[model samples]
Target chain A: MLKKSGTTLIEIMIALFVLASAMIPIASIMGYGGRATSKDARRILAMQLLDKTLRQMLQADYDEIPIGKNIQNGFEGIALGDVTAGQDKGFSFNISLDSEYVNPVKFKYRGVGVNRPTFKADSPVGDDFLPEETISLNDVVIKLTVTVTWNEQQNLPVSVSAMTYRADFQRRTG
Target chain B: MHYLDAKRSGMALIIVLTLATGILILGISYINTIRKQSGRNTIELGAIQADLLAEGLTQIAMLKFKEIPGPLYYAYIAHVKGNTSQPYSVYHGDAILGGKLDSPFNAEFRTTFQLLSSKMYQDMNVKITVEVEVSRPDGEKYQRLIERTVSGSRRPAF
Candidate 1:
């Protein structure tokens, strides 16, 4: 009793409190880790899906290429079970040539509010950027960007994307 | 008795601090994970939209191609929408190898595609390109080029 030794109940409680406090943060981090894992997995899956679609389109004939909002609606007319409409992960595929580069904005259906911004064929806004009329699309260079998003705060929603490009295939002409 | 009281109080403080730190770390981690998930979701949806756009461009081109009555085709422009905010720009080119109108937009991203093929691949092939741009509400811009070159042949009779 004279010599102070062994942890007092008070000290034990204190230690426990500290440990408990520490655990809170750890738990939060763990929660975050779980979500991160989900994102990573989804990213990978999204990439695989995009690649599959691109490859299929590449191999298929023009008519066979599924067009317009149909792909977004899904392989079928409706969305997959458990997958909501807005929740669908979509892909965009584009094929171009030298002529299209001349006026990219006008060439692409999405770009609005301008007639034609004539940039030289070699400048960053011109012809030399994508491989010059490659032997084929493999020579052409195809790009893909996969994005997955979810709402965390308000409706602001956060999105993560992975992008890749396929070297244009050499054009096979008789 | 006073000394003992002080020690216990000190311990409590330490415990509280430690717990706070733990919670902070966890909260941060969770936020990060959530942010990442949100990003991925955006990527997936965007990709799917792009795929449809590419296919649409080709189908439309085919229809336009058929309308033209000759083989030495003229450039026909294909203007499709992208992110939703922008207007529908014009892409005027040959009906066959659909050439571009030659604009002064960012090449890698802002540029659009047109077919320049001389003839169909094996009389059944169809080739078209759709331009996809990845732009964030936060002001970051990326570009995606989707090209579909498909070969077609006569269907077999059952």
Candidate 2:
């Protein structure tokens, strides 16, 4: 009347069930972490692209910079491989160069004449100073913005941007 | 027969306990590694943001410089001509241009400009330094300094 020497079918099934249950939560956690890491990587890529494009725009001549927003399919020179039309590795690039007039700073040459206007005037220079000259300083400054966006997992949209002013003292379109 | 059945059940229980402990330890370590990686990523991103903020602020400072070119040029001339009083602060003060940050990025900046070369009749070469202090919602703070040399020539009056 010896009993069985090994685990019964019921015991084995219970063990398997416990192990499977434990692994399920662990698998989900790992999956979540993997997705987060991927999102971080894509964000980094988008940031780099935004920075590079912004710098390029800064270097361009102010007049050469096209005013108004322009959108492109994707970034170039990044070999992410085989992107479909209208999307480059699931990223899009946008750039805008906007120009606006700035208030003129009225400056007066403190003398009776234009040349060598620095002389100490006999009369109050404030009253007898040369006519205030208005220089169009706004033409030299342009607001440049570069942005990159991508659809993350679950169709969640993420973006990175860099903006700065591009000034060209030589070109005065105003 | 009872003794044999009890022995088999005990061994099965021991095996299951050991496997469960091992799996838990592995999962905890894995989670810990992922957490550390995420932290590092956040730090890297913050650094990039700080750098870009500093640079953008520098550009704004340059625009500020451009705005007062006439006054700055005259002040430089006066300083060179034995005027002991330097009127730089009158035209461009500390924090030349500030307070233009967009949402989600909190930063404060202090800007200072030094006249590197004021050679007569030459463009005034100014050294602009921008100091930025950035604070993120995640309790991370970063400070950055950026220096740029810009040549300022007074624009002709139209």
- TM-score, chain B, model 2, is 0.67
Please write out the lDDT profile of model 2 over residues A1-174, one tens digit for every residue: 223523465577777778787888878877877877776677666667656666665566556665555434223332221222233555443332233322332222222242555554222223223443333444555655555667776777665555565656444334
Which stretches of candidate 1 lie above 4 Å from their native place?
A1-3, A6-9, A28-174, B1-27, B69-127, B134-142, B149-158
lDDT of 1 by residue, A66-165 (tens): 3222123223221211231213543222221111111211112212112235522111222212221211111132333333344432444544333333
lDDT of 2 by residue, B126-153 (tens): 8888877777678898888989998755
Pick the DockQ winner: 2
Task: Looking at model 2, give its docking quality level.
Answer: acceptable
CA lDDT, every model vs. true structure = 0.39, 0.58
What lDDT does candidate 1 reach at residue A46? 43
